[model samples]
Target: MSDPHATSPEDVDLSRFDAIVDVRPQAQTRPHLPESTFTPLERLLEDPAASLPSTSARVLVVCDIGMRSAIAARELAELGYQSVTSLDGGIDAWRRHGLPLAGTDSLTPNELERFDRQIKIPDIGSTGQSKLRSASVTVIGAGGLGSPVISYLAGAGIGTLRIVDPDVVELSNLQRQPIYALSDLGRPKVAAAADSVAATTTQTATEIVQGSFDSSSAADLIEGSTVVVDATDSFQARYDLSDATRKAEVPLVTGAVYRWEGQITTLVPNGACYRCIFPSPPESAARLDCALVGAVGPVVGTIGTLQATEVIRISAGLAPAYAGRLLMYDGAVGTFSSVSVQARPDCVCQRP
Candidate 1:
């Protein structure tokens, strides 16, 4: 029999449910079933901190074989629930018992059409889409890397974009930066990028700051921006962004792409600042700009895409997340690796 007491992970405290399903019948079933929605241990660990059915939760655990379900139920015992029981015959039993599956009729007509794609995803539905639409992001450059960053940020429905770049477009930028066309050759990077936002995603308001973004400008931008994407290529620019965003305690999604190499790192206040990672400028600086060197189209695309993903996730309230971690990508080999970030004890602390 299904228990009347069902506790979800969102229910912070137990004492919510009155009945719990017994999983004795689950043990007799097979290990796996074709139609089961039950999540495997590996899948659960992949999203580490996602709330699951707590053993103390009064949830009616469904399993193909009640045996495994009961076993999994015990995993939530320490969560302070009173029950983590399973169905008598699992989902099969629930079916035989004539329990009705929830219907989609609860959705409004427009909602059903608007969120058709999101509704299909398990965790992200209308709720997540709304969160995404209301997200605010700040892009710390409107040049090469920022081009893709701004385009995708707008396409993603970021409610607002604050672009910080003091440069203008030039003929040399045509090779890699496509956000600006030849007609926009002389326009400031921020102005041209803002125009792109209006043309594509009018819903996202673009604010262009014509001045350079130093420690002071960074503070104002970080104040209301939920996420900051560092598309700046220069080491000095990256360091300034790191120090300033860290001081403002904003999450910084920093990315840089050269010929075929790219790197991304997400930083918060206590995160390892770029200063901590690249403690001092290289003995001899590598002033390699595509104008001087060259770059592949997809290289910046891949890196900027990663930065966009991090920003969306930060705005979406995800946890067990990326902070103080550097992710490096090599488009040539198509390999990606990551390492943890740490504070530099020898470095001077700079505030926003």
Candidate 2:
């Protein structure tokens, strides 16, 4: 007989379940069934409304053992999920039964081998990787933050990458933009960034748009992207992208870096926006740009890496950490902190 608390692998029909929601801690290593969606237990416990999708489709919850899965099943049930079940014995029982399992879904032989390690992640299974492969991300600026953002996103298998930048690679750019080499000097930054994206993974296709990000073109550039990344140093560019993205109702991941400090945050359509925190630009003379204030390569790299990480999480259909929070990194002190934010009542972004 099946256990009263959970259903055994033999009793659970995978074909009947529309989706499997893994609620284990990410540190635990377990081979995930193909097409499974990962939502860490803590995330679900803290905010199930945001972490979980609003689906009526039947979902099976699983973990290393049945304990966490049972908890997740109960949480879903309490949330009014019509049909929620726990996989008895979790993945361990499933594997012990010699049942059919797929590490990833819709992956070609080469892709399967290429992303083998990533495919093993319970939350990012084949479906998540497929999402990554089908996503198109546009990154504005190919400078400090853009370099690592472009490189890592491409390496993560972002299928379509559109690099937009009006500047040309310079000898000084080599310090922070390692994606370019000495030979790239004098060449358009978009060209070098596109080339770097191509070299990272054969699965990713690259596009180059040579233009500065401004009010007029920001909307057009961000229109069709799966995600828009703001990697520019200018406040004007950041404000322009923020306004355009908010108006477009598209997700925006913006990053900024000073000499030893950097900040990153994601602005979803209905959530807090960049303007909520800073309604107006800093005083004219008080503004600082990387060119004038200078920056350490690693500081920008840290912020860029975080930006890329958020992009991947967004692509994977996972909630981003910075959605309602601003993450600040202090390279000089080696510390990271975050502050919560909300949409201001009178903010223009609140308008429908």
Candidate 3:
């Protein structure tokens, strides 16, 4: 076995092995092996459970290094396996490298390959990506917050992106709103931002609403949408979005950044809508706008990226990430804080 290629698949250490149970013909990955011990998830993904023995069984995953087996062992536990052990030394280090072992497989459909990168996540897989294609999302505001939100959602292949922004970008907005170049300063942000989304590979379709989200028209804007992002910069609009999204029964990803500080929260269906968190709108403060306080690029960027992440997660059939929680950041101190939130019992959004 000393030849260059023949010297491969060496022996592995078993000192750190959690437990090694060969299930090729035996049993035990979880504490109570079902009539058959094969993972139900695997059954649903590939072959049927009828292919496995009905007595009991466990599986061993062999990798170049035992490290991956160790990691996969943990993965099985998280998937409801009470007892999953790994080979301390990997396949390369195994004494009986040729030992019989049952192997698992993957699903690699042609369409799924386009989203190969996304399907790798546990929270989001090919199944989740499919849900995203069937989901609709509405984003309010097309400035700083909407920039990254639209960009990522588009890049993530969200099925539909609906943007409603009645404002135009001003010359002064180039500081943080990079979606609009200096060349299009006076153009409506909705059009410019919509164009940005239209260029992404994952973006399938987009709709731009050139109007503010008011009481009368909010219903149409919220119709059939899975979620809404409140990236607007006005207190009235934020509150309006909060109220409207609540009635629409869609999760709301709200973002706010001032100077070097930023905060994000999932509202409406996730928790008490924003009104519960901010009981009464802080007395109107005309002087505290991002324009007045001066927001840094990264601050708004941070908030916007999180807003998009929340939107995609919810659309993709994952639980609302920020449900009952708020994430606040202080750039100066680099401190982050999260607090719990509850829905107001008597809020007017009892129906959506």
Candidate 4:
């Protein structure tokens, strides 16, 4: 006789169950059935009440090859789960039956584990994680602002990072640009940034563009990129990147720091561009370089971290936080403020 407590993949109708539970090991449980809850068999066996919903709910348990799920179903039934069933062949059979799975199939079991905590977020679940795994971001500079931006993005599992910089690491850069060490002094910033990203996560691929980001090179550097980050120190480079990304219809996250103050914003195609805010570069006397006036390391780090978050949000298909506004931070007072901004009618960004 066949087991009444088990159902085959052909008989499964996901809508009928209040909860579909995966009882496989955590590492093997990703890319599971859509909207399925993951409660490893070990955890479920130890405490069914804590691991799952009410026992009266219609539940379906699945595993790798069906054995564990079958055992779990029987145990749950004995524990007074009114309606529970196991997948007769588990995920293996579901796969054979050509059913849909959620995460990216390209991710290995190890990659799943490495990103387990991030993948657990409801908003950034396996689907969002997959998007991140396929995203490519082009960072315009590898200095203070780029340091935290690159580090955090790599940690967040961004698929590809293209770092562009024309300068070499100097002793003064070590204050805010943590991606390099003393030994790296005099080495190209792009190369050092690539090595830093590699150390953070092997899953991310790094492309080092050892050149400046200007109108001539901006198009090619940001081609095929999901987003472009403006971590440049000069207003000229920022304006160039903003125009390039706007023309290409790609999103751009731009940030700046001076002394203990910093600001960041995101610009999307057809929306407000950088010129909408500044209109033109500040006069040479007004423009302050960190090297000339000095900057607080944490101030740049703070702005860079926020810029990275914006990049991740855009890459994962979420709304940009600072799309048409500027977020400013005052490290001296430990306060943050935001100002609304709009597209300039007379600026090139508004031209057809």
Candidate 5:
């Protein structure tokens, strides 16, 4: 018969324990069993009664492997505790049994393996990964800038990606928009972008809107989005997105590329919005189009990658890096620079 004071991880009825305590070091106690209280093995060894609940309580002790918890359980038993048990193989064995962990229960085994590298990061732990899986980001274009943004965000495991674009792919787009191919020519940009994202990862759901993003449709397009990305090539669309995001109180990652230069910035609600940098759209006559000035593929890619980074960071519960600042890249010179931005007192963002 098994020792009454020891139980296998697979056989333990967690609900029966009045107190489930983790006896590992504080740092090693992450991803522990649900509802478990932390009491390091060293502390329990120092003062068993002081480190635990009432001796009469039904307690379950756990550690990384079975060693620490077994020792802890023996100490508790020697102290005349009414009932106590140790997890046979500890948390490692429990994990091997495919049991649920406290902060990562929602993530599937595939997701844990897919995002393992990032999850190891102290700041972007399992909690941040969960946030990424719950976030929705709406990208307003699927061309040069939107291609990389959609691709990376999908790879990063964004839960939902809503793509809005009215244009169709063409031969000219292949020069910069790597998300599409010759076979995708004449296909709607949104549809093609969604296919690219689908090929990247199944974790993110894609929402395709085969329509232009204008003032009339901006709000409806961005509704329920955790973040918005402005990747359109027109000043008019930028102005509309700036106004719409500000009004909706959503964060916007806006970027632009012209020739060999590109600039990116993140606009958070109540912060310096796009309009704070450009109070109004420039005159049509003065505006330069990518078709006219010609865009460099890497230039747009650089900005798009940065925009994707901002969205992932924001979705993961981190502060926006470029909020109230403009980050500019000059590919021709291989240089980067930033300038501080402030909201205009009379700007629409500052109004009620």
Candidate 6:
């Protein structure tokens, strides 16, 4: 019942705690409790949906001298953690009580230990993780590009993922769409993708739209998204989603892959819209889908992964890579390149 943030060192007790979290910067924490875990304040702030112990568990947050730990505990309380507190004097107070110090590390004990590496990245840290937890992203398609995009986004803990695809999983899709299994062949792509995302992380809420994405349904499917990703193979769907997002002043991350080649770009409200680059749709005779063109698995993966990265970056308040540029990936030669894009004066996207 004691407030860890307010308890004095003389009255401190560790046995009452279910877990002790050290939130100090790793550099400043040379000696920490042997049993305590280290997760910096920024990391905790970034990961809005961190999978901590059960709400019933007693968690005591600690920092170098208690300032940040108190802040973190308050944040956890606001997030509805049932029992949370901060160490008053932090590690310094613990040492004063002659407690054994542990190494500098902070992560909850969970099966998803694989995320430790990325959680330590300065830019993404815990804060970025939290942002991903709060973000809602809608990916249009569950095919090759959608496969990687969905996998990465789901794995990264995107709070809500809306998958829209009218097609069903097919035998031919196994080569690149790793999110589906042989048994999923007859299932709708959105259903299969939802199952895949659920299996990846329970933190992400998967929304399925088992039909085509178009102007008619765009508002319902994508209007609330923090970012829209175009992974659909058809140009019509891409243009539809792009136009809808453009009108809503939302950002869209889109990519395309064809025969060992792929391209990625971000269409922001104020920047050049997708139509600015094309002016008009390609002729029916010239239009090509993967069915007619053929593409390698890695090509789609590369572009899809890039699209996912852009979504993550944008959600985390970081600069998007292809806002006014097109990133081209040549899988045959294993090279990546980019070209600047400008808003067409005559295009509707140029209007205020």
Q: What is the lDDT of residue 299 in candidate 1?
A: 83
Model 4: lDDT of residue 304:
95
lDDT of each: 0.64, 0.83, 0.67, 0.87, 0.87, 0.79
* Candidate 6, 217-284: lDDT as tens digits: 98888878899999988887777888999888789998988788899999998888878887777675
lDDT of 5 at 65: 81
The candidate that wins on TM-score is: 5
List where candidate 4 sits over 4 angstroms from the true fold: 1-31, 34-82, 85-106, 284-288
**What ranges in model 5 sit over 4 Å off?**
1-30, 37-93, 282-288
**Each prediction's Cα RMSD?**
10.0, 8.7, 9.6, 7.5, 4.9, 11.4
Local lDDT at 273 for model 6? 80
Candidate 1's C-alpha runs over 4 A off are 1-119, 350-352
Candidate 1 per-residue lDDT over residues 13-110, each given as its tens digit? 22344333323222222222222334454443344135344433455445543544555555544434565544444544443443432223233444
User: Model 1's lDDT to the true fold?
Assistant: 0.64
**lDDT by residue (tens digit), candidate 2, 16-60:** 887777887662233566667778887876776665556476788
lDDT of 4 by residue, 1-352 (tens): 6788999999999999999888876623256777788888889988988867898989999987789999999999998998999989887788678787665556666766788787766567667788898999999899999999999999999999999999999999999988899989999999888988887788899999898888998889999999999998888788888888999999999998989899999998967998888886767524447878889999999999999999999988789999889999999999999998899899887777
What is the alpha-carbon lDDT of model 5 when measured against the actual structure? 0.87
* Positional deviation of residue 232's Cα in model 3 after best superposition, in angstroms: 0.5
Q: Per model, how many backbone clashes are there?
A: 11, 2, 8, 0, 0, 18
Q: Assess candidate 2 and give its lDDT.
A: 0.83
Question: Which consecutive 10 residues in model 4 have the weakest lDDT in total?
Answer: 280-289
Using TM-score as the measure, name the better of candidate 3 and candidate 6.
Answer: 6
